[model samples]
Target: MLINDGLVRARGVRYATASRFAKPEPLAWDGARPSERGPACPQPPSALAALVGNSVEGLSFDERCQVLSVTAPADASGLPVMVWFHGGAYVTGSGESTKYEASLLASEGVVVVSVSYRLGVFGYLRDNLGLLDQLTALRWVRDNITAFGGDPANVTAFGQSAGGDSVYALMLVDTENLFHRAILQSAPLGTRSPERAEMTAALRSSISVDESTSVEDALAAQTAAVTEVGPKFPPSGGMPFAPVLDDVDLTAAASRVELLVGHTADDGSPYVPSREHWEAVTELIFAGGARELARDWAAACGQVATYTFRWAPADAPLGSCHCMELPFLFDPDGWRGAGMLAGQEPDPVLAGTMRSLWAGFARNGMDALPSRSLEFGG
Candidate 1:
């Protein structure tokens, strides 16, 4: 184990294996082994680097990226588990990013797992292979997290942006009781995923890239495909690759677990040029979708909590945009150079409270949540 600051950290724990553009199959592991950090799925530079900084700065890229990292308190047992999914609109981002180190969250008496799944044409092109990678990771946690002091039955799946979108999708498809609760941070639920017809056409554009294609060529094809077909989807065109919304009934899924879901107060600020544009995008792509999901789940008898993160440096330009709350939930040093934080320190009290609330939710579900419609950094 890679012990750090009294935490037993296991990095690059492979949970599944897959061929290029194929479905992921679960892999067995002998729990708690030391390994190198997994390479992120191959992709282009993050489109949001100007706003959130380069999260994957030093990471290598590879096709076999179905891996995860686990961090837990040393000499602990029976602790709650928090599985994380990093966000990048299904095209970018990796859970192995330094920006997502979970030491702070783990210090709160929980085990944290950060997942790295396939991305772009390598993942979402043929099918939901990236999501299947997540399912395999959850199964791995169920069977092996006990060795690292996590309670298998009390797993909580949490994510942000595309990652958050992923958690919501997992809630709908999870059948093995893989997780009992979910925390969806800034999930863009209002962004419509491409239908089958659209996906098929997009798939056709990247059809030339197979197992033998150079990684660079494959990425180029992925970009070309998006460029060719993205305009049809308009506002969500930049994020053309997303989880396909199939005919899954949410009523059953909704009733199975408690959920905490919401977005930042100015989630669209970084993406838009004006306050009016920010309001439109924030509502249409973030707030509206989040509120709808909470309402639907609650109406279906599911326990739900929501929040609006309004925290930002006093002179920061983005004003609590998407990803602003992340620094509060993870190790401060990891975000030391993050543009999203605006070079100012996150308030220690606020960071501690965010960690406590998230860990509390992992341990006690809805009971850990404050009253609904809570506002942070207001």
Candidate 2:
């Protein structure tokens, strides 16, 4: 049967089955018939090899939580594995977003897994409760990836924006060596203090409570207030809740992972323009400390693998905005109207270049520079 947006479904799960794409086969049970459902179930259409959607259950801290896992088919010569975290300020976003398609990356002969964890008020509000959900998700990958044809040893952790911030935090907490390599895109490393304070103040302000309020009482009150606001509150400054450096989860430590960091030319523009709200956006999000944070981040990331792209199209109203190069990097088919790729087919030159660079980093700790002429050493 056809699923939403032309995806094919057999049983209850949906599978991407375009003729240009190979169909994934269902996972086999350990000792039962092929028809028997296993703990880790996969999908159908044998051409694609494997596509399994499983969950890592019984998390230690949060009883109701589970980390969703998406495993792709293996490569012809056994490619590496990349565990990707989606960027939505750590408050919003999931692994299932189309913005993070791993098909192109997987085609490079590497298994890719996109992770989903708790978000917003749920994930980042740990007091002394010791909730290491993100780390737990990583541990789950380390333990279970082999079942999905992935090499845990060669895993690379990569993320953008808030996800990128998480990557750096992972480094600080001695989890750097867990992944072979790391890629941080458009994230501010040194700006966490102010940003965390802002998030805390916003959360406190949302509840109209003081800082002395207990975690449990604050959470209860906030939940009630939010419910009064009707299910989900309207998107505002109070929504993108992130982690705070409570001397536990985040600490002062040098990063040990091989880092590849870069920023777009103009990552401060709007995707959809509104003349009325333009002034406000310019004054708030794009002004003052936000601008300085990017520069400060570059300065702080000193001597790491750094490359800056000033991508701009003559017809485009703005230069490279936040997430502008993602489409090119991922080679998404529908992103033709984005940045430099506007009204054109996916450029093989760019796609191949990025794939090779990223693949080399994943395979080894070193970032394979795309061009020798481009200076990557900060």
Candidate 3:
């Protein structure tokens, strides 16, 4: 049930909801088909459309906004659409990051939309204010997707880490009817109280501003403070920048989405300052608090399809690190062993297998194909 804020205005001719989700009939390509042999590539400039708009929160400048699209071949009817939010710990990254290239999914007849929202102080610092931004993004997608050849009723929201956390939050407070399914990678449900406290403290210290300071002033102080800290990860526990149980956007309750959640075997090493840091984070994020949180999360999910991926490809480096499966999934040859795709080699077979599984999940509520060694229902 979408509560129209009366702020949403459609620019194009209003298409009836019936035309939005109707199954598309397949079309045939008359020209020479491009090579579908190697990694899927984006079609040339002519084939894609671009969209820009204010965030759901209504905070960002009109020009500083979002992007959505239909990337699949035009002929593919009834293709599923995925709205992807990237992982950056609520601080960094953009929709334009190379790691999120959606060509592979697009090639498989999925319309992929990558979003750009406010980051760091701009998006997350409002105590409970930032949630509106996320909600607005979802609402925008819901109202405008049909124009881009997507099914508004069949959308799936998927993300990694912080983005994954957002997926869960969306399900909880999401009254906009924005998405029907969810995929969460390497993110657990909640944070330890101590960890939350620490994050709040760090944000406060960085700002050095009163808790009651105006959002604009707080953002200015935060930007200056972080610049002095250099590129290092901010000290944890500073501000109420992350999602919290506000009873408005979130109700301190569990969510029910067809969840596909898991962590890589070595998800903690990349941020480790030393072996001890590695051990501590692993204990906290995975074995310690995270494990307990997972139990509670499972209870909330009810009859969920669950799985754990222990991917240790032979070519991977010593540490599997966060986001290691991306290159394998996208099979972007150059991106192999860098950023999220670090510690991976280009494996066509693995890429194909993973893409098919993702597509299947987006198309239906299934986790993955039966043929793949991918496990579920644990």
Candidate 1 has a TM-score of: 0.96
lDDT of 3 by residue, 1-378 (tens): 111221111111111111111221222222222221111111111100111011121112221333332344454455677877766555544444455656676676676766554455545544533344556666766665665457778888887766776776777777656787777776634342445544554554666554355545655675665555423333333223456643332223335345555665666666565756765565556434334444555666532344444555564443555565666554274364353333445456666766777778888765444631244211
Cα lDDT of model 2 by residue, 77-191, tens digit: 3456777765655544455444555566666666666655554444554430112445555665566566555677777778776667676666555443566567777664434
Q: Where does model 2 exceed 4 Å of error? A: 1-65, 71-78, 127-131, 174-176, 188-191, 198-202, 208-240, 246-255, 271-303, 334-346, 370-378
- lDDT of the candidates, in the order given: 0.86, 0.47, 0.50
lDDT of 1 by residue, 1-378 (tens): 688789998888889889887889888896647657888998898878977788888888888999899999998799999999999989898998888989889999999999999988888877778888999999999999999999998999999999998998899889888999999999988775434447546666655787898999988988887877776666567477766767757788777788999899999888878989998999988999899899888989888999888888988877888898998998878778677777898898998998999999899988787877677886
lDDT of 3: 0.50
- Higher-lDDT candidate among 1 and 2? 1
RMSD to the native, candidate 3? 11.7
Top candidate when judged by lDDT against the true structure: 1
Q: How does model 2 fare in lDDT?
A: 0.47
**Per-residue lDDT of 319 in model 1:** 84
What lDDT score goes with residue 253 in model 2?
A: 30
Best by TM-score: 1
TM-score of each: 0.96, 0.62, 0.67
In model 3, which runs have C-alpha deviations exceeding 4 angstroms?
1-63, 188-220, 223-240, 247-256, 273-280, 286-298, 312-318, 331-344, 367-378
